[model samples]
Target: MSIKIENLTHIYMPGSPFEKRALDEVSIDIQDGEFVALIGHTGSGKSTLIQHINGLLKPSSGKIIIDNVDITGDKVKLSDIRKKVGLVFQYPEYQLFEETIEKDIAFGPKNLGLDEAEISKRVIKAMNMVGLDYESYKDKSPFDLSGGQKRRVAIAGVVAMEPKVLILDEPTAGLDPKGRDEILDKIKDLRKEYNMTIILVSHSMEDVAKVATRILVMHQGKCILDGTPKEVFKEVEVLEKVGLAVPQVTYLAKKLKQKGFNISEDIFTIEEAKYEILKLLKGANNND
Candidate 1:
């Protein structure tokens, strides 16, 4: 599903001494099936903006339209909106409490009032979607599983709900390299299999470079940049001013270019750097 935000503004404790404006006239359009990466330093309103998308927080003054429905309307029900927009918060595994993995995965579908048979089917499907073997993990305790496994089960619970839009906030937070890669790969698989719109809020420029089709940069409660990864990463100076950094490889590429090497400063991934280096070497050999 596509999301449209127009003139969106949000405030905390409005009219109070500690009042803070979290979002300021923020507006953007997220097209269907787009993997959008939201990046910002702390207190830049990234979290607050996403909460408005899923109806977890109301806009102080603006409109949040999902699939052409004005979700901010009084007539709209938040619960109904939530069913279509599933948010997997940071460290989602901390929310798991069911006795077994099967029950945890079944939680959301069951709440949707699906029949027992249908719920069972969804649980199995969700497990498979997350690459967890149903037979092997179904009866196991979620707490007994490894950290990454627990996270997968948590994601499965949300997947069971069959949301059209999936929003993940720091999904790979606190994970080791292997665990982090596993989560990212699973997210990619989920997007391919389900064709859902994904909004990933992350700090890792490397991870975003690898997965995001588009990037949004927020600073001081305003969206300062919005474009494809290549377009956004090109503004390294602006990003750095906001306390954000591009992928390390992008920096390396920039330095190489400064040193009089013919390389594109837009290289954002290690693989891209390797390819460019090889091509440069080949070109030099031909010249020699």
Candidate 2:
């Protein structure tokens, strides 16, 4: 599913004294099967913009076209759009309420009126997609699991819905390093397996740099930058101006380059930085 937003603007409490603009004439195009990472500081319209994508919120003055249909228009069914676009909120594990893990994951498919056999199949598939073994965790209480396991279950619930477009808002917000990697790896695997269009709203520049095929930077209710991670993170000064920081490795690489080291300033990950340093060392040894 491709998504196109044209002149999209959204406001809260439109005629009231406390009315505020949350999205300001933001326009962007998201192609099918693209992994887009949306980044911004708090109050930058990141949350507000995504809500419009799945019909949770309407545009105040523009149009949102999903798969060539203008979803913002009155004739469009919001429910239908929602079924195609699944959103997993931050700390989604807190919302789990089923007696068993399988039931929690089966909830969405069950709600869709899928047959018993199909719903069970979907629940198992979804759990497996998130690295959970159906036989091990099926009958366990969600609240009794670890933080990361609970989160995976929560994500599996959304995955079972089989949305073409999956949007996650801070999926790894409170996870430990290992837990974070698990969630991110599952996301990567899901994209490859299903060819789903993924829009991830994240605060960790390191996480986005590692996984995002494209990055969208927002500032004060507007989309200020959009490009590949390399392209977007290269503008360190601009990002800093908006109270956002690029990955620490990118910063280290930039400083090293400025100090006359033979290193690439565009590096975004620890692995990349390590490779560049090793290359520089090899060059030095050759000259010696």
Candidate 3:
């Protein structure tokens, strides 16, 4: 499903001494099947903005249109909107409580009142999507799994809901490097395999550059930048001013360029940097 936010504004503690504008006339359009990453430092309004997408929070002013429907309309059911847009918050494993993995993953589908057969189908499918084998993990306690496995189970719970759009906030927070990579791979696979529009709120520029098709930079309650990864990371000065930076590899590439190397500084990934450096070495060898 597509999402369109127009002039959205949200205020916290209105009329109080702590009144703050969490979102300020922010606007964005996310098309279906796009992996959009939302990046910003703390207090940049990234968290607050995702909460408004599925109606968890209401906009103080402006409109939210999902799939051409005005979700901000008074008569629209927030519950329905939520089903179409599943949100997995940071450290979702902390929310797990079921005795067995299957039960935990089945919670959302069961809440929808599906019959036993359909619920089983959805549970198995969701587990498979997250790389969990239903035959082995179905009866295992969620708490018994490794950290990465537990996270996958949490994400499977949302996947069972069959949402058209998925929003993940810091999905890899607090995990070791290996675990983080596994989760990111699962997220990438989910988007391609299910064609779900995904909005990821992240702090890691390397992760964003690796997977995000587009990036939206949020700062001081406004969306300061919006474009593909290549486009957004090009604004190194603006991002640094907001306490953000491009991928580490991008900075390294810039340093090489300053040394008079025949390499492009626009490189965003380690793989790209390696390729460019190898090509430059090949040219040097030919001249020798």
Candidate 4:
């Protein structure tokens, strides 16, 4: 589903001495099936913004339109809005309390009041999407599985709900390299198979560069940059001032350009860098 936010502003403790403005007239449009990475420093309103999208937190002022429905309307039910926007928070594995993986994944579908047959189908489908073998892991205790496996099960619960938009907040927060890769791969797979709009709130520029088709940079309660990965990363100076950085490979590419090598500074991924390097080598060989 597509999302439109217009003049969105949010505040905390409105009448108190500790009142703070968490978001300020932040507006963004996210088209269907777009993987958008929301990046910002800690307390830069990243978390507050995602909460508003899912209707978990109400905006102090502004409109959040999902698929043309104004969720901010007083007449609109938050529960109905949530059905179309599923949020998977960081360390989702800690939320798992079911006796088995199957039950844990089935929880959301069951709450939707789906019948047994349909619920079972969705549970199995969700497991497969996250790369968990239904036959092998279905009956196992979620807590007994490895950290990555437990995290997948937790994510499957949200996937089974089959929301039109999936919002993941720091999905790879504390995983090791292998576990992190597993989660990221599942995210890619989910987008491909489900065609859901995914908003990923992350701190790792490398992870976003690898998967995000678009990036949104937030700072001091305002959205300062919104563009494709290359366009956003090109503002390295601005991002640095906001306490953010582009992918490490993008820095390397910039250094190569400075050293008089013919390389694109926009190259942010290892694969892109390797291809550019190979092309340069091929050109030198032809001259030789």
Candidate 5:
């Protein structure tokens, strides 16, 4: 859904000695069903910002509006906000606790007070969304599944909620390349099938470049850049200074550009890079 954050600021501890402002009057408007990648260095308030979207952490100052409703106000129910905006924390596998895969996925629907049939339907749908088979794996113990399976089951828990906005915080962290690709692909499919807003908090610039339609760059609790990946990543020095890397291909293209290759340097994905390089090669052939 649409999210409006106007002059938002989050102070970690208001009166305590350790008081620190995590978000500094940040303001932005995110359209519905947009794929947004939020990135920054350690302690850059990226996590704090997503937490505010779902009302996990209330803003010390400013208002948050989701779907035209003021979710940050005192009267808004946190549960309602959470239902519409699902926040899947880093390493969701650590959150799995139910005995069976079915129960684990059903946990969210059960919490929502859905009836037996409805919960069963949601469980099956969510399980399938994560590439889990219901008939074969439903009764199996979640603990017995492989690391990837367990992670999928955990994601199923959030999918069952069918939230309008899905916020994933470092979802692929600590996983092998294959596992990371699997999770990222699932997210891409979920966005396409469900048409829901996707917010990705990640450290991998390549991964973000692959899926994000818009990028939000944070530094020291303030947003420094917000734009398309091509636009944001074109500036290499600022990102490097902030402890972030551009996609490898983008960096390679930038280096080529610096060397007077006359190449388009703003490509974000390998496929795009391949096409651009091939086009340039064809142009050289024509000239020769």
Candidate 6:
């Protein structure tokens, strides 16, 4: 479902000595079924904004309209709102406390008061989506799983909820290179299979460049940039100024252009760069 935020401003501890404005007149329209990446430095209000999307934090003064209804209005239940938007926080593994992986993954569905048969079915589906074996690992203690497995288990908990929109905050934090790849691929597959809208909060431009169709950049409580990944990354200096680096492939393409090679500047993936370079060499040889 599409989300519309207008004149959003969030104030913490209003009329107090420690008053802080987390979001300063921030507004954006998130289209449905789009893979969106939210980027910002440490305290740029990225976390605060996402919280408002799911009604975890109420905006002091603004409107959050989802699917054409202003749910930010009174008389709307937060539980009902969350039923449509699933949120996976940073280091979600810490929240998995059930005795066994099966129970933990089933926690969300069970909370909805589903029957045992349906809950069991959802648990199995979620586990398999994350590449976890249900037969071998379902009965095992979640605490016994490795870090990567634990992360997957945590994600399965959210998947079990079957929300229309999935919001993930730093989903690959603290993972090794291989773990990061596996998790990203699994998430991509889940989005494709379920046709769920995804809002990914992250710091890695490379990850977003590879997946997100649109990127939003925040700086010090305000959204400074918003566009397609290629459009946003075109301003590499601005991205770097905001404490985010451009994708390595974009950098390499820029360097090649400066070295008198006729290469496309919109390169974000390594494979795209390799293909363009090969074509450029062929054209140069024909000229010779």
Q: Number of backbone collisions per candidate, in order?
A: 0, 0, 0, 0, 0, 0
Task: Report the C-alpha lDDT of model 6 over 1-288, residue by residue, as the tens digit.
Answer: 999999899999999999999999988999989999999998899999999989899899999998777878888888988988899999999998999999999989999989999999999999999999999999999999888899999999998999988999999999997998899889998899788999999998878887898999999889999999889999988988878888899989989899988899999987788899899989989999
Worst 10 residues of 5 by lDDT: 146-155
Off by over 4 Å in 3: none
Better of 2 and 5 by lDDT: 2
Task: Give the lDDT of residue 45 in candidate 3.
Answer: 98
lDDT of 2 at 258: 90
lDDT of 3 by residue, 151-235 (tens): 9999999999989999999998888988888899999999988899999999999889888999999999999999999999999
Clashing pairs in 6: none
> Can you give the lDDT of residue 172 in candidate 2?
95
TM-score of each: 0.96, 0.97, 0.97, 0.97, 0.94, 0.95
lDDT of 1 by residue, 157-239 (tens): 99899999999999999899899889999999999988999999999999999899999999989999999999999898899
RMSD (Å) per prediction: 1.4, 1.2, 1.1, 1.2, 1.7, 1.6
lDDT of all the models against the reference?
0.93, 0.93, 0.94, 0.93, 0.90, 0.91
Worst 10 residues of 6 by lDDT: 66-75
Q: Mind sharing the TM-score for model 2?
A: 0.97
Residue pairs whose backbone atoms clash in candidate 5: none
Using lDDT as the measure, name the better of candidate 5 and candidate 6.
6
Compared with the true structure, what per-residue lDDT tens digits does model 5 show for residues 44-146? Answer: 9999999999898888999999999998887889898899999899888889988899988888989998899999989888888889889999999989987
Of candidates 6 and 2, the better by lDDT: 2
